[model samples]
Target: MFQLSLATVSHGAVASIPLILVAPFALLLLLIATMPLTPPRVKHLWEHYYPHIAIGLGLVVAAYYLWRVEGGGTVIGHTAHEYFSFISLIGALYVVAGGIHIKVKGESTPVVNVAFLAVGAVLANFIGTTGASMVMIRPWIRLNKIRISAFHIVFFIFVVSNVGGALTPIGDPPLFLGYLRGVPFFWLLDHVIGQWIVTLVALLVAFYVFDRRSFARMPVRLRHESEAPDTWRFDGMMNVLFLGVIIAAVFLPDYWFLREIVMLGAAVASYRLTPKDVHLENHFSFGPIKEVAFLFIGIFATMMPALNYLEQHGHEFGFERAPAYYFASGGLSAVLDNAPTYVNFLKLAEVSASTGGGGESTPAAEHAAVHQLLADRPELVIAVSLGAVFFGAMTYIGNGPNFMVKSIAESAGVRVPSFFGYIGRYSLPILLPILAVCGWIFLH
Candidate 1:
């Protein structure tokens, strides 16, 4: 094994990594952030052709890195492993959760909306935010069809689609990335449950107030001449069984490779056994998961050298305080994909933490490796984890499911806000202030 070290690599090594190697990645990210928000025609062009652009740019970076750098092949191997696990879990959850259907007969009253959102929030843990959002959004939207408003979907993104995923690895991509980096599967239960509770409660309270005010002006009318169902019934319930097995797979025996195999098997079982009608009703398609995997391919490949650069000289980009990691990881997450953003910051924290000597101030004192910092300097990982997952609601592009929810709603005739309108009207006004309070209370 070729170990990575600053002393061995040297300051010249950092300089040797040309600025050009990172340009394609920078361009791809900038395009992702901007293309959809730009004029429609140009946006269409980018969307249609983004794969070609990313692939070409990725080949450029990969070819040069393999040619010029030592241990470059190892970087590719690690990125490949990370990408495989990350995408597999996401794909499995998407397929399996799609098979479980929520059927409700109710009006979307203030209380009903709250209960629905609350259930979705809790459910986000078992099935991922994307899965939960996919299964729940349609029924919720239908129940509220008579009096649906923009605030409904936005708040859905805030709580169920993003913030609620804080508690589990299966719940969100960023947390799953943390799990891949040796953070324990159940780590968030001890470290983040309180923060998750406070944030969810505050948002739910705000939602109740806002939703009730919306309710007052609107007439209470059910779309059909029927009373609400006494209890919700689920179709294709066997997927729920499969989901449990998949969750257990992550921590079962600590065999990393088996975990992926188990998850893939669960997905296959769900698809094979679940009723076809259930999938059709859930609008289950490979499109969203396929898009995620495709874009992340470029991200994983192009990010290797950047991560290596950070590993060799990460301490230079100082984030000494705990809050710095929280805010920076979160801020980038708002614009960039949160998964890579999470990994980038985690690597930064780990490398920076690695250089620290013992508190005893002795030359012979024990040094910490990046992996062990989870226990030694727990605050750092907690903040980074929270920020990446929670702040994903900051924009439609923050997480994969955000845009999917918006698209699903729009497809169903609900008018969603434009990308910039989403940030300016809702996220900036609603989410930012609450995040500030959270930062002050928890992060600082």
Candidate 2:
């Protein structure tokens, strides 16, 4: 394995090394720079596309630098493989939204233990929270087609998009990191359910408050649309089978490559075997998923240096002095991407503590024993995971599905808020307060 010298990586303070710390803002600038080059019809496209593109470019540049200059000892292919694996996983889930699972009752509420809940629960663990969000949100909105308030959409984004999927390994990236780090798959059940409950309750409260207002304001004489064919109706069930193949690729990739390829081959064959009206009717465009995957590729690549430095020396910067590390890491993660954020903090915790079993950490230390302590202190994993997954709802760019939701909502002619406007109006007022409670309940 290749490693950069801690001395070399940390030589510049977080602020001085622009790629490590300032890259996100720089990337945003590049996006702004490129907007005039895009066509007017696609002006809307730039708004949704630019941040992600900048993030991906930044990641690529960072990865290239580490490989060539730092002798970071990682192959480009290895990193790219890891990078696109996330994209593919995200794409597969994006394609089969329901395969990721989200429960809804009467288009607005979700009941525990019902079939939809069961599907959502299963998919949330299998694909990811965002994957589940993309699949469920559209259907959910359509189910409540009569509801016209924007707050309803905003609330749905809050609960289903952010809070609901924090529990299982596949539900969120941070938890997946925990699973990779030897935390038992079911560990979240014991540690995170309380936090999840608080989030769900907050969602329910927001739903009731908003739903009542929306119902009252709904027009008394709603127009029925022209006699267009129902999109929900399908001639081919094979698309569902293809979606299933994608899910298999997600949770059990090795198995998917092995015997599961046979299943995938069968699913594709079914696609050809099915009628054109069915498969082509809902031809899944690569646009939304591609935008997210590509953009995040840049973010992960560019942020590597920052992540390395933070892991080696973050405690010296007074993270331990603030209750805000949980929020800070996660808040930055909303823009920077959470996978690396979780790793950075996990490494920081590892470096700051003395080795003891259970969730306890000793005073800060300079020795490798701190790494051992981090290895042992799995409870800290809960905090890191919770922080990354939950706080991702802080902004539209926080996670991929968020941008997708925004795009879909806009395409449907629903008025959405601007980036800052979104935070001020929708996320801050509704989601951030809930996140604050979650942080207190989970961290304090």
Candidate 3:
């Protein structure tokens, strides 16, 4: 990574450059070229949603540039792989519990939907947001299909998809990554209580107001159908054990490889022991996890050089030199992948601290820098974790499992919002403000 940074700095932007930044253009061209061959339904679904495809491909370009300019060998790449694989296991647990449902009915009335949202919030910590999203989005939509509004889906993406996951390691990928790196499983609880409480309260309040509006506008037929049973019931309760196994895998990652093997066998055994209807009726497939597995493999493979370079050289950029850097790093991560960005900034701080401790940095200078950095740690962790988990709601590609949720929901006949459409509607109004507040508290 050092070598690329040096080259980029020395040679300027033209150094070893390709013509026309072909990566993104090429990706665009390829996607456009494939339109003719694409299935009609897929083409129709994606033509409007092309921005997501374009951006996913653009990430490849960004990775290449970072790799070419930064000189890290494979560290960043490996982290992406490990992180995704870990999240996937967590996602599987959500699947088993049938926890990933959407709040379709009573979205207009808080009384009916509050229970669903509450369950989703708690389940998010246990199963991960990706898990909760998959399980919930469908049911929520199915229940409320009679009353279709952009906000319905947008709200789902905001609260259930992002905010609900803030409290635990398993609730968000960034937090889970923190856990694997030695942040205690429950440490986040201590650090983020203020932010979580504030955000949670804000979410509940917003949900109540919005749901009341939605309910008032709901059709009478739909309203009657929604009232059949406000009381929730469970089926295939045995799936909770599968959910537990997934959590055990996350909390006990050292034994993950072994645990995965055991769990795979167990899931298969359980499938056989149970009635066929449970698996068939749930209509579960490996599609969500598999999409994440593949897309993230690319992200992992490509981001290596960039992450390594950031690790070594980021301090010189003068961002982490203040509390502002924490928010800056975390905010940028909302647009970029958060894992490498977190490592990059964290490493930069650690490196600066070490260098300052030595005579390499003057004592007076060292004193100022460390103190500035020291004060930032609380906010820094919050910035990174909050940005990674929440800003991800900004776009489908912001996080691994987002696209899967869109794809699955579409397959089930519920159209999802477009890339910019999603951000403009859902995140901009709801999540963005909350996250902006978080950024303000941390950065300012």
Candidate 4:
């Protein structure tokens, strides 16, 4: 059995890490992006053993870091902590939100579809994108079952699953990671709401046009024509109360351990209290969350040395402008986990801000960079935050909800695009243009 020794990890003397160590991570991204395009047999074998591949690569990366620097241990410890908090939050929300089943009798008209996504946008800020997706996806699917298309799910991924989560920390994992690192919980709302609203509005308008055009392309006989109900019914309603308890715990002062325990208990209560029949109807299973939990282990570990290396030398890459930061974060986020990427760039920004003004940076200046960052935080933070959240919609694995929403749609029989297909067809032609506009409007 392969084992990772958490105890052996320690931050040794400050040592510069070589850039060569980033290859495994780059290769991992390449495999993920290109495998589906390979021949069927090759893709099948690769997919079947992808987890093993990820683990092997992660071990190799970790070993390299361990041998090279004492800081490897610190990276491991911090990663474990971040991974724990991340998976716990995801698992809790997935379990609890799965308990909720919203039923509204309606025909899935273009207008109605837009409304559903809009509501999801608002709800995501509080319940989180993953939870909001779980709660709303089934109903949206049911409403559009008659004329459902991949485009429906794609647009939903854009508006609800990613871009909509920009307002609060709980809204998305990357933002929440920032919160854990002493960023104010409400910082995104204060700094990013303008960009969020503009981006969301443009996407919504674009979706309406696209959906209308697509609907018109389909045969008239195939479309379901019905109105949204004046009222809606929610099953497993008590879980709503439990959801509140979990969110409240997030805001609790002190008692970090207690908060985690209560959150676990709350998740348990949700599972036990929710009817099995509801789960069956919702097609709720632990599969998606389990897959995420497993895959992200490699993500956090393999990313460690890369992150550490980036922290030391990131500013040297010469991405000095806010737009550059925006694109750097968002572009990678399209193909990678936004959480670590967010942290990587955040550290870069802080370090750069802390450095001497156009001169050699001293230790005291570097130490003071953190405070300086927060003072005029609006520009860098806005760019990074929006970039991470927005481009995370570009692919299935870009963000947690992107995958969850895809899995749920597949379970309901909507065929999502392949990884490259999503970017080439949906995200590139659709989201990319909108993102350029957002950059023009805000990041510049």
Instruction: Indicate which candidate wins on lDDT.
Output: 1
Give lDDT: candidate 4, residue 38: 83
lDDT of 1 by residue, 210-308 (tens): 888876766445433223553577898888888888888877653567888998999998999988899899888888887787787888888765665
Worst 10 residues of 2 by lDDT: 357-366
Model 4 lDDT tens row, 59-153: 88778667865556556566667677777777788899889999867566678778889899998987889889888988888877767888888
Candidate closer to the true structure by TM-score (higher is better), 1 or 3: 1
lDDT of predicted model 1 = 0.79
Lowest lDDT 10-residue stretch of candidate 3: 357-366
- What TM-score, to 2 decimals, does candidate 4 have? 0.85
Q: Which stretches of candidate 1 lie over 4 Å from their true place?
A: 1-15, 220-231, 252-256, 356-368
Q: Which candidate leads the pack in TM-score? A: 1
lDDT of 2 by residue, 39-75 (tens): 7867788766666567656655655556454333342
Residue 238's lDDT in candidate 2: 48
Q: Where does candidate 3 stray beyond 4 Å?
A: 1-88, 94-108, 219-228, 253-275, 321-330, 337-345, 352-376, 411-416
After superposition, the stretches of candidate 4 with alpha carbons farther than 4 Å from their true spots are 1-12, 16-19, 32-51, 60-68, 71-74, 213-225, 228-231, 253-256, 356-371, 415-421
What ordering of candidates by TM-score runs from best to worst?
Answer: 1, 4, 3, 2
Name the better of 1 and 4 by lDDT.
1
